[model samples]
Target: MSEPRFVVVRNDEEQYSIWSADRELPPGWHDAGFTGTRAECLAHVDEVWTDMRPRSVREAAR
Candidate 1:
């Protein structure tokens, strides 16, 4: 089978979440702050994902 895909969604200031295409939000998906900037949020997301699994273009979608 192919690997899972994840989507990072920002809801409000200092709030964000991540989910898989075929699943609900995973643990630690929203343990970080939004920081009011795309770069900051993405950086935190990258850090969070790095601790769990490697990231790939195919694994992250809108």
Candidate 2:
């Protein structure tokens, strides 16, 4: 069987990354609930990670 192409992950800083779904996630990261090809996952992040700033920073700005 072929491996998954990509997966979306995020860290405490709320930054997003497109990781190889065939590998293990590193520390301080969790699945962002998205899975697809690298381009697809990155497109998902592009649609979702709109604020561009960390949650904390956004909250502080308010």
Candidate 3:
């Protein structure tokens, strides 16, 4: 049996999360183009999503 597949996703706020690669993405979220096992996806998010702040919050601070 194959392990569950996950895809990295990002919202308008630029926050990152993982979702089932085979399922429809939630509203306001888009695929970040990376797919793999849950751990792999999380690692990718961890690497890329260095800042935890949302887009608006980061922008406002600028």
Candidate 4:
């Protein structure tokens, strides 16, 4: 399996943020109702790679 890529995005209200681990996620995109503690967020990032699509080296390097 490949490693995960992560990006942080803030909600419209800017009250909280989510750390997305999928390579396809665009900048500034936010998911709803995805709250987690700091540690949970890190764990989510680590595990997300298992379910996320693998990115090519070129794609990842970009």
Best by lDDT: 3
lDDT of each residue in 1-62, candidate 2, tens digit only: 85469999999989998899889999999999999987899899999998889878988999
**Cα lDDT of model 4 by residue, 1-62, tens digit:** 74444444434433233564544444555654344555666565555434233344435667
Q: Write the per-residue lDDT of candidate 3 for residues 4-24, one digit (tens) a residue.
A: 999999999999999998999
Name the candidate, 1 or 2, with the larger TM-score value.
2
Model 1 lDDT at residue 3 = 47
lDDT of 1 by residue, 1-62 (tens): 84444456543232445544455545445433334344545666766554342344335642
List TM-scores for all candidates, in order. Answer: 0.32, 0.86, 0.96, 0.32
RMSD of each: 14.3, 2.0, 0.5, 12.7
Candidate with top TM-score is: 3
**Alpha carbon lDDT of each predicted model:** 0.47, 0.90, 0.97, 0.47
What residue pairs clash in candidate 1, if any at all? Answer: none
Candidate 3, residue 6: the lDDT equals 100
Better of 3 and 4 by TM-score: 3
- Worst ten in a row by lDDT for model 4: 8-17
Backbone clashes, each candidate: 0, 0, 0, 0
Worst 10 residues of 2 by lDDT: 1-10
Instruction: Mark the regions of model 4 whose C-alpha exceeds 4 Å error after superposition.
Output: 1-27, 50-62
